[model samples]
Target: MGSITVSGVGKAYKFYSSRWARLAEWLSPFHKRRHTLKWVLQDINVSIGQGESVGVLGVNGAGKSTLLKMITGTTQPTTGSISINGRMAALLELGMGFHPDFTGRQNVFMAGQLLGYQAGEIAELMPEIEAFAEIGDYIDQPVRVYSSGMQVRLAFSVATMKKPDILIVDEALSVGDAYFQAKCFQRINNFRQNGTTLLLVSHSPGDVVKHCDRAILLKGGRVAMDSSSREVTNRYLDELFGKPDEAPADAEASIPTDSAAAHGLSQHDDVFHSRPGYHPSEHRWGHGGASIIDFLVSTPDASYPSRIESNTQTEFYFTVRFDSDFDQVVPGFLLKTLEGIFLYGTNSYLSSRGTAHHSAQAGSVQTYRFSMPMALNEGHYLVSFGISSGDPRQDLVPLDRRYDSVLIHVGRDVQFWGIADLRATYQQLNA
Candidate 1:
């Protein structure tokens, strides 16, 4: 089987004092002295099974690249061993190992040879590579003239042409436009279905959780956690926000209504309210000082649970309580698909009426309401809301934030397709 085994692996580089010191270290084999070394990875042990997809996640300087470099043979580990049982292809840094003077065609041929393909083998794959790249006649031009996106296209096409037993995709995909990114993901999904062991390194938790079955979190040159993708991403986020506890038990509970509307939602609990299995604790983060006491989605017709048809008007109400005074308060909401792709969002700072910069005393409450048409197709969506202090368009700081706090389901007629319903019209024109 095509599998990878990394045992007690670590990588270190010599820390030379200066250019002359580096020269001295290089020539020191005759002098019996070595330069000081600093470790970037340490004691990393993991075994990836055949056909498994694993995500390597970490912040910058977390040794993720160092680990992948060792596995791909670009560099050697300072200690321990790495074992691979099959052919592999890697898309590491942008434009890595490509000659600036070489044309795209020449670079493809050279890369194929480096990956152990014969001239005839590369010739047989050229057509497919060209078709996938879609860079047109620029394929015959020097790679130095290519844009970042074009380079990624050619590099990705070359890396995936042979469908090697192992595939390693780094953050190169992040440079592509949205369309190319989608295409790359489709190809990766195809490889996964066809039993190619895949290793994906990315900073986006949504991408990791969507594509990988398991993940490893790295921090300070060591493995921080190894678990299912969702759990590992949760741990990673906790590290980013520096919070230890999950969202409060009543995070999804709406703000308490006064005597006027307190009983408004009692009758429709089974229909409009959040479905079972969705809780705020699943995805929520922010700083303290202000708390979102209640957040709810409702229809314009005054329905409490926010049950609505696609293309209908809806309203989102957020009630925030302040623990301290602030110079500016900005409230915002995000609409995301179940897969965590952000489809739409808006903040008070960008409203047409103009930005609102307001201050409040401690223990005061503010309620902000937004009215809009829901043009989404039939799907389950998550609502994320936040209250921030400072210019949201600038260096905004969150006072309180909750992600995936409310789950809403939209029902649509048979005509709509895809994410948004544009209410499009078509006419036949003939001569």
Candidate 2:
């Protein structure tokens, strides 16, 4: 029977012209209003049944945190009312109540008192809290010295020590490392399973859709949309990023095959290093007898686009010249994360075409192309090219290796995290 209710709720802050104006107003027998009210939240009405998971999503300055603070009793609403019908625990702004000069252990005791735990009860749970935080001896040091991640760890540990009937988590957890974020979400999932009402605040549409049953989107301190998480997040994405109306081509579109036709490059141009995504800081090393010259990267409609939308299949074309005769040569390309973690790579020798090696005498050139679906989440990534004479792992002689030579920006390919775009879907079942 526990739930949250927000009815015509609004919040505002006082703005005075000067300190003397405030003093004069306070000193006057008939005090006149000398301050103006700046409204941060307006006419927000929401009701949640027991155990419902709702997400509050907005860009910065949208009054999401202000509403949560009002419900949690940390701040008062300027108009209307907010009520909570459960034992509530919240992880608000990081280190909100922590004393900078106090050690983490002491702060934990103080925060625990605020949460209705007596000294003896906190002592009983101290081992569990310390085990969960895992901050080591820094737990004995002043809160001022803790990193943002460390502060989140302690705050979250204390708030979640004993799961209440309700839980409110803000974006403060986003500052933690990936491992801790995973741990926190796992705990939240377990709480949800046990019928705990949850409120998650985040900028990520993927997180909202995955963890929440419903979502409320705020814009300009007003409730913009309140609906299913998917619907609200879709609107939020368009609002936040202003995506184009025309979606990316689902299947590859027909594009000009020749570099001269597609990219306005000379057929014999040696401008591989001048392309749009070319990286000047690329690491280059190889034997000197071969060179990679003209290159082109094309989507279905554009040549060397600054950003690729969705998981579009794209092609890369490059021409290589042999200065000295070679017994055999192999051309290859690979994709990597911005931090240089390899994703997928393939060589001409490994293709199904059965054209493993090409023999070229001195003063000979050949064009090579590789096409792949950019199956990655939205982020910045790098592409590399190489030419070698042997196996990739052993006795390999790299003739021309351009490491991280091109930077590709993928836009809204997947509404999820991680490097790969694992197109996932959900369906409700009839029980």
Candidate 3:
């Protein structure tokens, strides 16, 4: 049975003010003078059956890492019980279990032994592990010399080579390259298909939605929501951005101004060259003061191109409607990778090109267009749009925000390193 059952699990630490205070507490068990008990996780209970994929979602300091540790047996819970059956393998932290003095190849055997494998078995699996890690000669080098990415590759390869009954991955893919991260997901998917219990922890909601069958949201050291991935994700967003409501006022009393034309943007800028019959698939939320009616992504020539060319300029036209008068309005967009890693973002408050502030009455519809060059590498990107008020750089409030509003595809097999195509220039100087 590869099932995991956690009952009334809680973790706490004795926090002391000074170094001597810890000594004093150690000297006398009943002293308890200065140290305070701090609970990182409280009353967490969950059950996972064999071959089930579950995701743990939470913000920083929400005790996600603490819960993972307790499940992995790295740390014991201060209160309650945990029962885990079958062989369990975990990638909790970068370079967590490996010794600094040992080589990557040696650490593979070490980790295998810790996982209840004989020397002969580990030896047989060494070649597979070495090939999967792809660290070549560095496999014989000390692990201390390996970069964080290399260490993650080795650890992930070793943990997954043997096919444990229970596999736990805790943000380990965040350190690897994009290609390697994709490979890790494929491996995890294979584990799910082959009947291995999977427990994944990530801050990315997209990751949870893509990989987990069920998801649990942790807030303030407690279970906030537990349901299907879609329900949990929606609830998580609600908790984050507050509940969305209807517009507060009518849209007819607002001033109509040509802001796009004011910025030298016109219908001629609609460059929808190759893209045909475009339809938007967007997820929206925000306060009810205003709404984003529609948006367009094209070139300066007014042609809607199917894919963006590298190192070329593209324009984004966002049409927003206001039901109530507002003193300030901010419109923006963000580009993120398919894996939900943010690549770039800009807003009216932060951009030098857009108008400073927009004052509007009820029933106002305005279109704001932004010009940005496509300096990104060849990949599929998602655009998140936002219409907000107040200081967007500081305490901003979203009037309307849409995630994945536009899906952008940049074609051509350009082997550019990193996310942005920096367009670096090189010149050789004689020595």
Winning model by lDDT: 2
Query: What's model 3's TM-score?
Result: 0.62
Q: Give TM per candidate.
A: 0.63, 0.64, 0.62
lDDT of each: 0.78, 0.82, 0.76
Q: Which TM-score value belongs to model 1?
A: 0.63
Give lDDT for model 3.
Answer: 0.76
Pairs with steric clashes in candidate 1:
255-294
lDDT-based ranking:
2, 1, 3
**Tens digits of lDDT, candidate 3, 160-238:** 9877789999998899998898888888898889889999898656577678989989989999888897577655644
Minimal lDDT window, size 10, model 1: 263-272
Give the per-residue lDDT digits (tens) of candidate 2, residues 89-148: 999899889999999999999999999999999999999999989899999999999999
Whole-model lDDT, model 1: 0.78
Report the lDDT of model 3 for residue 74. Answer: 84
> Residue 285's C-alpha lDDT in candidate 3?
89
